[model samples]
Target: MQLMHKGSALVTDQDIGENPSVIEHAKRMGLRLITFGPHCNAQVREMGFHNGNLQIGMGSLRLGISLQSDGHHMALNAQAALAALHALGYAPAQVQASLAHWQPMIGAGQPQLLPSGICLLDHSLSNHLLSMTAAFSQLQSVAPHVSRRLIVLAGIQPGQASIDAAQLALEPLVRDAQARRVLLYGEPLRPLAAALGDLLHVNWYDDLNQLICSLLRTTHKGDTVLLAGRATTNLALAADAIRDSFSGHGGHLIASIQAPCFDPHQKQMNMHS
Candidate 1:
């Protein structure tokens, strides 16, 4: 890609691996390059939950990046944009100030509190592991004092690889969150259930109705529920069922839907893909 200005470029290590030639090309073109990863300049200095949002402290800012789950990738994108802006004669403070009004799009870690004091982490819209992990961590941090934690995992696609990926992604949460119970819907859960065995209170269901029934029956007040996974087909139905199931209950619901991006030039938001 040709640059209009000789600006600095920030590329994550993962991105570099995916497009090393592009990085090399950019470097050769005289762009100052900054790489971020486990050992790089884009270290997440500090991370915590504040006012029901995730706050990441980096660089010189004591009150660092504060955003919702939807802003996870956008945070990194913002960093790159900041680098470009700084190279184009904008002050660091000016760039930061411009982002003050930015907000997370829908389905990007949007939390909804139900009537029963139950909080829902709705990440059902997308199934990217990194974003899901960030959302889970944010919820875990914010609701540490909740009475119980529940996970409603959608069924993965039919394949050993899909099952394996789901297992790997969920193992940490199951162990760390100390989840009181888990309601898994779909065929991909069989192996996972077998693997978890007695370690977790897992309830597997092939039918969506049964799964929702069990979820409603088991959930109680002061509990946190995380609804996630890659159920591409029945996501909308499941969301509606859950909403109706918890209608009178005094709990909270956080439905993660794909939110639109705001186009500053157009002064409007673009639809989620």
Candidate 2:
């Protein structure tokens, strides 16, 4: 998930749990990295990074850049995409969106691909907070059976101490618990889960390895997991490690929503390797 900025050499570090040394290399290239979780440094929040977007903090005169962020209307696009896909075939029973490192995920492979052109492209500030709000009503439409499907979210936020942005997404995600079954799990989940509820929350880290292992064992092809937050690198690497741990017995264990979107043609992220 490490992408060098297009014009100049500015690579923003998106994950906080990654090796600091590699991030230093990115810095040497004139790229700035941003962290979006509690484990991040104070300086990261000072720069305007939290959820999934990383604003290059390096002194600029730069041109066309390679920036990676999935905040704001990005959720809108997922919502629209889900709706369209539902009408098509994928018929995702439920849709949940959040900024707790887990964002909404769109699966490929045998996913019952929906129509295209329904992605969110706006990365504006004004558009970020309201992204979740706009989709809230849409989230309310699921039937009881459809709500049984759990939609998880994970990603960095756009601002610091992310209460506003988090709530923006949370308000809608938890609106339906009986039918939709929204689960909120994260490192700092006690307060959030209490404020939100078990049906809508859980302290994520409490059973991280176990939970991931369980998911790896039971998750099907059409199901998706959106991993965001912390440093993009750390989360990505963690996912990599988790996948590797399950390598060999079954088919590919990790199916990410990362881009270049993950060319299934290659069947792996490190295509260069």
Candidate 3:
């Protein structure tokens, strides 16, 4: 609201509840409102994506913009950018062409290939479940050759009303990713680790440094690591630690550890001590 001025345009998606309120507020302030999404009534609408490209159909005008990043969320974010551009009176063709050069910054689902051949998807900047799901989807698309996928979850806020419901919601995401082992860090995620229980191989960690070092020492080549957390958790530090490990002596140390991180007979590794 602070960003808006007289004759300015408000651009947003249909999912935001602030839309109607913002529209009324815009009208009072003489601000133009523009919305774009799957089910929004606006000048720009009909937005969707396939593979890594975003498609927007505004009436008879169609624009297909290639995304430099991964996931469904990126497509929506790009569509919102396009809508914002539309509100700003930019040509659709110009916006489409310009967006081709856009790339996601670190910690926003950007895939990083360490020198040790571990593909790390750092999504620690975000805490939402939807974003985590998108990160898993990204893994399926980008690292098909990954022999083992290890999830280094800083935390997860399920937002569900009950433990069973939250477990039901989270179970499939882990299973679908085919994660060989799950390493969870921080106190906020104890319920998350508990929810997974014995159904999936899960390890709980209180010491962030230990978790980082353990994964570094155990994970091998052809392994993909998905790091998910929020800013408050300082999960980005963990991502950095993993990246730094490979560039230094830690890389040599990982090569010497056993091939797989988990024992075939063990379902969970408790590192609370």
Ranking by lDDT: 3, 1, 2
Q: Write the per-residue lDDT of candidate 3 for residues 157-264, one digit (tens) a residue.
A: 556555335434555787677677788777666666766776446777766655766777667787888888766777787787778776555555445433434445
Show model 2 residue runs off by greater than 4 Å.
1-148, 155-171, 177-185, 198-203, 217-273
**Residue 97 CA displacement from its true place in model 3, Å:** 3.7
Which candidate number would show the highest lDDT if scored against the true structure? 3
lDDT tens string, model 2, 1-273? 355652232222234325677566656666544332223341222233334443222223111211222443343333333333433344233322222234333221011111221121111112233443333322233213442233333332546656535544554344443323332334433344455543432323333433344334433333332233334213343344333433333234343323222234422111112
Total backbone collisions for each predicted model? 17, 26, 0
State the RMSD for candidate 2. Answer: 19.3
Tens digit per residue, CA lDDT, model 1, 1-273 = 475346655444434624668667776776655433223344332244445243433466533444433434555555555545544556656756555456555444566677767776676765666666766686687578534778777644434465566655565665676677776666665566655666647666666655655566677778777777774746545555556556673233322221211222322111111
Q: How accurate is candidate 3 locally (lDDT)?
A: 0.71
lDDT at residue 261 of model 1 (Cα atoms): 16
TM-score of 3: 0.74
Candidate 3's C-alpha runs over 4 A off are 1-6, 14-31, 39-42, 46-48, 141-147, 157-172, 247-273
